[model samples]
Target: MMAGMKFLSGKRSIFKVMGLICKKCALAIMVLALIAPFIATTQIILGDSKSDLEDAKKQQEDVQSKLEETKKYIEDLQGQVSDIQSYISSLDSQMETISSSLYELDLQVQDLEATIKTTEEELAKAEEDAKVQYEQMKLRIKFMYEHNDETYLGMLLNAEDMADLLSKAEYINQLSKYDREMLEKYKATIDYIAQTKADLEADKEELVNMQTNLQDQMSALSLLQSTKMTQLTNLNNTVAAEESYYSRLEAENEALEATTRQLEARIKAEEAAKSSVTSYDGGKFKWPTTSTRITSDYGDTDGRSAPHKGIDIGAVKVGVAGDPIYAAYDGKVVISTYSASAGNYIMIYHGDGLYTRYLHCSSLLVSVGDYVTKGQKIGLMGTTGNSTGVHLHFDVRLNGSYVSPWNYLSK
Candidate 1:
């Protein structure tokens, strides 16, 4: 009985030890399985972090390049503003001088009117005197014709002696000479009066024409003044209230200059960043349409003489409304919209303050933030906005402002 009890106790101890060893082995296997997954996850996390760093660096470089370009644009705009201001100042000076000249012309016209009136009166008096003299001369001519033969015959028959006959002949010659002289004097007076009247009438007609011309000139001057006043008002409004337009212009210029300086500073900072990073170069650009006759050049003034900032190409050859429109440059789609004024429109950011716009599109093939390469199909053409017919309203912009699209594209 004692041997049996010892055997049973030994067997139980061995079984317990075996179970403990098996439990340890299973725990070791479980730990290894769990640790393997963690190792794989760590590797994946490291790879993702590296990729994110690379992406961030690339984005930073792009931002830097854009900042540099924006600075250059701001500088150019500031210079243009300065030049416009100088031209406007010169125009104002010219306007003042023109106003003074016009005032003097008005006084001259008034004086001419008075002279014309006096000349008219003088001409009327001269015409009446000429009529009276003409009538007196006609009566004398009739009387001489009626009595001259009778007198000559009677004088010849009544001659008593040679001396008397000679005296009568001298008297007849004197009378005839006197009549002839009087007739010539009267004709000369009438001719002089007619000439004077004709000259006065011409002078009066010229004065009337001068008055009409003066009135026309005044109307033109008034229009010019009104236009100038409107332009001045606009300039003043744009510059705000500075008491003097010149002073206001100077102040606005100063502000623009300061902004330009700040932009330059930012550009320099971006340049430094770009130097350390690999830049993501933009893709090649493609033609926006197949049609290529430019009906109007960019920045051309229309019939109203309104300045046109975009180029107008002939769209008659191209298919309307559903004609594929391609991207002109590599850019990210920034805006896609439809409005009553712009119709279906799309804006693409070509980086560095350079943007392109497609207007009057019948259809849009892109959304905002879609990165596109040059020559990629984008939209279609249609009649939209302030358009007479179906045409693509294409435009190029530098730093959020419109510029001549022709400058960037070939015919």
Candidate 2:
């Protein structure tokens, strides 16, 4: 009987121990319940990080699209860099914007990284706690399973009254619900962490691609700028040479005018003898150079002591040589010769006292007295005379006096 009484005493002790375990389990479940909302808040923050990354990508995409347009627009230069100053300014503007965008994006990425770091630490702690809570729950379940009958018997033996017994029973039932809920929460935390990690990695990769794309755009722009700079340098040199040419052009032109008048006297003598030019059909003169880009107009007097005598038509690419010079009208070549001031020149008489002269040819195609049709390729544009750059100096004379070529030019 004494041994039986000792056994009951031990059983009561076990009941007390089990009651303490149950209390600990309840505290763990309550802690999980409280922290559940915090984890949900963290999940929302993670979503916000994703949105910020996406927004940054969108901004870069916009800049990238504009760069593409710039790339295409730069291609329209067609071997010439004319009017390149304006385009260079445009490129500067675009680069400024791109630089600003990059700075802004970098700032945002830094902000996101800090935010993610803090949030990840919190999430990792929460996840570890949830795992611990789950482990505790499993241990409790195994203990209850191993001593299922004894656990309930201990509860009954330990209850002080009916109210207490019912309360303990209800508490045990609530623990099962806590177990299920805590398990779900733990799974959710793990999933959120995984998704956040994936998003971070993908965002990093996309940022790298954006950087590479920007580099390509910069390279293309640099190439275009280099080409334009070369053209600009050539143009500056040519302009200086042209200024020098104009300084001595007036004195040189006086003698040239005399000689040209003498040549015309001979041509008129031939026409009188029915040996040279036929009567003109009367039409606007053809543009004399393959390129209609005029470097100097007929009456351009800027930086010149006297008005420029003829239009100077340069190649499409400034300072480039070997482009064709064409005949202004159907005429007989009067004199095809080189002189100090008018190197490799041509004089054409288009009857009715109209005459066209081409100067600074690299090589003359027709001989003196050769009849040529209008728009014929008469020579290659060059800078052979009192000139220093490749171009054609075209003149129009009516009755031995220089006239405005613009008056006879169609365009």
Candidate 3:
């Protein structure tokens, strides 16, 4: 009877222990089921956040590219405008010269016309004098022919003495000689006047032709100036339109940047509130990308008016994208978002107010609130936002102020 009671008690105890173990297992399973949904929901939220961030980054990149192109076009237009203006100025100078030449030509033409008029008047006077002289010579010849010729010859023949005949002959000879000399002088004067008039007409014709040619040239220059003016106006209008577009793009970029900054701040605040602080190992940080080749050094000017804030790590080969970007140090992710200037980026918060940032990522491997380790891949390198090419931009900050990442990076 004692053995039987002992066996039953031991069996009862074993059953109770097994039942307790089964109950505990059921409770543990229930708890896991309850927590799994939350984890799934959190993952979904993070995924959505990443998607939104990516979209914003893509929009920003497109706008930035267009803005840059517009600015460049504006610059080109401005150069063309300057060239046109210079051409117009040159035309003005040419027109001034043409005008001066035209004025001189007019004076020359006027002077030539006056000279021709004077020559014509002189020719007319010479013609009249020749006509008058010819009339006088004709009258003298007629008188001699009708009366003196016959009568004087008869008287000469009728003269009985040699002295009388000689006297009559001398008189007739003098009269004839005078008439011939007067006729010759009138003929020479008429010929000279005709030649002078002809020469004057030829010179006047030449001057008129020259004036016509000058007028045609002036018309051509005027037409060219008009065409240039039209082109300049069109260029000015185009430049104005481009400038307006550029201004709109600039405003949009500023707004995007502002929104990104706000989102980052909000995310940082939320992460700080939710996450437990992580301590840095006080060791040197690892390189953030696969390649150690520095495309740009910290504090170096990146072709901007300002100095660069971070160092850029390029891929092994130029123009290659999709390289892994690793965390520089172990820390909790404080910000995983997109920015117009930084693109798809993440900020890790190491305790004691230290932080690190990665920029221009193509895709993110980690999310906000995630704890990352040094050398752990967090994203992929890309040419996002305002980036020029595929690379990783790494920065370090202490108390919100940027510092050189080189200070903590391993050699």
All candidates' TM-scores? 0.32, 0.40, 0.53
Best-fitting candidate, scored by TM-score: 3
Error of 2 at 279 (Å): 46
TM-score of 1: 0.32
Q: Is candidate 2 or candidate 3 better by lDDT?
A: 3
Off by over 4 Å in 3: 1-48, 154-171, 273-411
Q: After superposing candidate 1 on the true structure, give the runs of residues whose Cα lies further than 4 Å from its correct spot.
A: 1-57, 149-411
Ranking by lDDT: 3, 2, 1
Q: Against the unseen true structure, what C-alpha lDDT does each candidate score?
A: 0.57, 0.67, 0.72
Per-residue lDDT over 1-411 for candidate 3, one digit per residue giving the tens place of the 0 to 100 score? 332353355345435534543554465356446534532332111212334455555656766876776677677678867866886786677678768877887888788778878878887887787788778878877877789657877989898899988987898788789778767877787677778778877877887787777677667667666766876787688677668767867776676666555555555554572357755567899888879989899899757687877888888788888999888888888777786677898888877777888888999898887888888999988888778898888888776577888789995
Off by over 4 Å in 2: 1-82, 200-208, 246-251, 254-411
What is the alpha-carbon lDDT of model 2 when measured against the actual structure?
A: 0.67
lDDT of 1 by residue, 1-411 (tens): 332343354345435534543454465356446434532332110112224344434434433443444344434434434544554454455446545665765676576567657666665665666567656767766876898778677887799988999999898788667766765665675566567656656765675665565455445445544544454454344333212323433443444344344334334433433343233354434558767656666777777466766666557564455667888977677566564566787777666666678877878899755677778898877777666667777777665467777566643
- Model 2, position 325: C-alpha lDDT score: 83
